[model samples]
Target: MSDGKTIILNRIREALRENPAPRPHASHTSSDQEETPRDHTPREWLPKVGERLDEQIDLFARQSEGLKTEFHRCGTMEDARAILSVLVAEGAWKKIATHTTPDTSALLEKNRAEILKTDTGYQIDDLESCDAGITGCECLVAQTGAILVSAPSAGGRALSVLPPHHIIIARTSQMVPDLTAALELAKERYGNKFPSFLSFITGPSRTGDIERILVLGAHGPKRLTVLLLED
Candidate 1:
């Protein structure tokens, strides 16, 4: 398993050995040239310097695995549907609570066959009782392998909090480089008017408070599966 740093170094080495590419010449600037230090509004506190969409996606998936979560890559919405079907079957997750979101509404219309026993009008009680809950995410933070979710997008936090198994479907476009970037995007999208509730899920809920032994799903879902679409 190659990490991003390893991959980047390898590419640099290969380019140096094979192409011997020349460095770009620096541009001349006026003596009085000045640049704005930062945006008027406070920017997100990003630890990582730059945005690398492809690399970020790879990192997100790898990091998710490190957190004991399953990550699947899909080429399209239909591909996502196929993967979802296989996961549902494998887990034997009946009585699923499917929330209504623009993203999921389209998925359900196109691939309802993959879903089993979904409660369209999902109730808080249904979320607690359902075998699994299927929903969309607000964003995925690659740096920390956390899923950024909000009440508006998830139709309430109960679907993600109460289900024994939580399934999330998101497109590549929703991938954020880091927590800072995710926050910036969310703020821009919502301004001072943010979602009523916001939550970050690193993986299935667990706690090590019991004798310092880490236990998975002690407080939340036992399984967390993410269907990442690569459109």
Candidate 2:
């Protein structure tokens, strides 16, 4: 065998001799004693989150920048509407897809583009053809800069994923510190009848498997924009 291969095999054999493998189902203690459970807390490993709202928002913004998410903090619904209008104009969007929520409906009332409501049902082809998808989120996670969406809160599943651009209209009240808090909020909001679909979207879809070169929109929306309005 090659010198490198022989050296590796010799090291493996030495390690095995020094540690001798234990027999199957070997027990050192009495069978009646129960084993201690492993710790399941995630906060032990996750990044620290601040208690104040402003700190959380700042962290979220920084994380969003790293993820390439377009995040806009609007002082009011009017400001959010203005931003949406600008996006529509810039993208030259002819049609947009959305589910009807009070906030979303009001924001898009004066919008010139044709609106396709996906709440009831919609054709996949029609949804795919839309320039953008607008939906309300279940919550925004500050820790990971993720937008949580469920079938009930957002328009089913396809509305947020099929369109080229995904727009999220959220409120400051919907922001949470981390995934644990977000899950708790969801549990509190929907006790027994949880929605069939729930997802945490961190950023626009991307892949870099082909040539180690990043490519966006490979599997989903090319752009993710968040318009967070003050409550």
Q: Please name the candidate that would achieve the greatest lDDT relative to the true structure.
A: 2
Q: For candidate 1, lDDT tens digit of each residue in 14-102? A: 87886766754435443543533342233343345236788888888778889998888877777777776776677676567777776
Model 1 is weakest, by summed lDDT over 10 consecutive residues, at: 35-44
Clashes of 2: 0
Clashes of each: 0, 0
TM-score for all predictions? Answer: 0.72, 0.83
> Candidate 1 has what TM-score?
0.72
- Pick by TM-score: which candidate is best? 2
What's the lDDT for candidate 2?
A: 0.90
Give per-residue CA lDDT, model 2, range 46-83, as digits (tens).
89899899988998899999999999999988888899
Q: Could you tell me which residue pairs clash in candidate 1? A: none
Local distance difference test scores for all models: 0.76, 0.90
Error of 1 at 201 (Å): 1.0
